[model samples]
Target chain A: MYPKSIKDLIEDFSKLPGVGEKTAERFVLFLATQKEKDGILSFSSHLKEMTDKIVKCERCHMLTEDTICDICKSKERDTETLMVVSDSKDVFVFEKMKTYHGQYHVLDGVIDFSKGISPEDLNIDSLLKKVASYKEVIIATNGTVEGELTAKYLKALLSDFNLSITRLAYGLPVGSDLKYADELTLNKAVENRQKY
Target chain B: MYPKSIKDLIEDFSKLPGVGEKTAERFVLFLATQKEKDGILSFSSHLKEMTDKIVKCERCHMLTEDTICDICKSKERDTETLMVVSDSKDVFVFEKMKTYHGQYHVLDGVIDFSKGISPEDLNIDSLLKKVASYKEVIIATNGTVEGELTAKYLKALLSDFNLSITRLAYGLPVGSDLKYADELTLNKAVENRQKY
Candidate 1:
């Protein structure tokens, strides 16, 4: 009703992120040029299906179908040294590093007081309860201002406990020689250095 | 295992008509950034559904579920005149005009001898048969060499029949005055003018 099929399809494609009107028109033209067997309309249905299905992991707040994520279910992971992150993608980043052996806790979002997001808005309370049983908890939040505030809030919440709580150090990366490190990074590395 | 998710997704997106590696990368990244509740992995499944579903109109060769298209099934329209077009979208153009009281015949494609497409390849026999039952048949193909050639071929094919066959008169569009018309369009309009 909005338009005949072709125009309607173009309008729909244009609504997607990064697809402009011109690009939407072009995509529709390209789609129409395809042979009947290509099933362009069915593709729209499929898009709706993907958007409708799929579940997020309950334990870590990452995307997963099971009640617990693969990392949470695994016995080989270091459950006592949990890594806290803001998003699920960060978990993947840590996994790809092959260095972190600990399980993960995803906040799903960073705490932003300006946007009205407080500690309660994040999964910090559950993380604190989880940390009560562990010997150590590592805050692997990003080095941004929001991340720093979230980590500091978390540190205060756990200050009464005797467990070791560490924030992922921000310094020059490995193999990035001291000479090539940016001034701020070199300065941080110098300031945060532990006794040899 | 070879970044199974990202690698497979990149490969699949890259296989689309005009998507290159960088665009494919961007597409995968966009999908990856989406919430897992959105079923990003099921994008592949959706692609399969599109290719497997959707039907074409048997009568007009347009994308439709029924044998006869909505235009052909409408009883209020005059069935005497048939506007012959190359694809389904052309029906939209004519529908926008709302001046003609005629049904449509979608040819699907024009006769392109250079590409080995002959009169038989474009459902010309069906068009000729339909023209026999019509008072007039209008050829509304694009203003290209191939379109013209196809129109000429249709005229020759329907020469022995007792029906009037006409092509859309080439000219400047209705909104444009003769002063603004391109030289080719103005010349064509003048050449094809009828007595008022």
Candidate 2:
């Protein structure tokens, strides 16, 4: 068994998205044993600093230090094109590509009835208010069932507006062998094959 | 790109063992966005608490809240038998089995030449001082190359003392099928087979 404070820290770490009790224990012990005397102290200070400074961007619902995110504030991005994503990390993924010049709107989470998340729980009111200004709305949620459902729901909501709503195309991932491709992915790839 | 404090936190998380930059980013984002407003603040406080409290046991070199660990302080333990381990975690593992009622001596680390970790860097000085009181010294380090090397080194050093030095038996792990066992494990199991 761990010391009281160590056990408490492990419990806190276990609350993170993917970390389990064993992983949390490993993390805590590594910090306690492996790091320098001031390592954990500095790490704790950094956590405090992040908690004090980071806030959700008012316009896009993305994590930012200021009221408006850098992406939302930038004038160079194509304001007419908006990419809707489930979480803020997706924004970074798109930005890393260096090709998407459009703005982003983080929904915070997708609609999952099983988890009791509904359309009203998402950051959609402001999205609906600003929908008329965008020429195209790209639903760029993940390829999961919840992502598909959210994309479909967003499409229906934005159908009344004079904007083209589109979902990301489904296909086999790049560099993946066809032999290992699943039936659903193969079906979609065949259905949406390019002329090339 | 992440904001200043968030980026700093991510870097700190990345320093943790087995955590990469992407996983660190996910951890920071999850802490910042998914958790309640005070979650990160509380987590930081807990880290500070752990740093302020936990200390290494004077005798065994295991992490504990007091000057001596519970195991070292306990009169119920078999002080004549000592278990020499590579890390403090190994002590906990042996304790959980409830079969080993011996005292423990944490070496803190194994003799890793690649990492420039020599026996001098470990807590072997105290071990050498106290090993004479024990009737048996069990070298319970891991099965890795470094662990075996450390065990051999300890055996040579402790050979001067009156105590009997022993190594843990190597064989297939419990609940593992023979077909699934690796060649090295199979070889070790065959070489060290027990009598029915």
Candidate number achieving the greatest TM-score relative to the actual structure: 2
- In the range B1-196, model 1's lDDT, one tens digit per residue, is 1134455555655655677866765665456557553354344343344344334566666555356667778898888888889977677667778888798888888888889988788867677666777888888888899999888888888778888888888877978777788898888988988889
Give the true-contact fraction for every prediction, in order.
Answer: 0.07, 0.79
Runs of candidate 1 with Cα error greater than 4 angstroms are: A1-54, A57-59, A65-86, A89-105, A112-119, A126-196, B1-54, B96-100, B112-116, B159-164, B168-196
What CAPRI class is candidate 1? incorrect
lDDT of 2 by residue, B1-196 (tens): 7889988999999998899999998998888885576777889999998888889999999989999999899999989999999898888678778899989999999999999999999999999998889999999999999999999999999999998899999999899899999999999999998889
What pairs collide in candidate 2? none
DockQ (CA atoms), all models: 0.10, 0.72
**How well does candidate 2 score on lDDT at residue B127?**
96
Q: What is the alpha-carbon lDDT of model 2 when measured against the actual structure?
A: 0.91
At residue A4, give the lDDT of candidate 1. Answer: 52
Give a tens-digit lDDT track for model 2, residues A1-196: 6788888999999997799998998998888885576878889999999888888899999889999999999999999999999999899888889999999999989999999999999999989998889999999998899999999899989999999888889999999999999999999999999998
Candidate 2: which stretches are off by over 4 Å? B179-196
Model 1 chain A: ten consecutive residues of lowest lDDT: A45-54
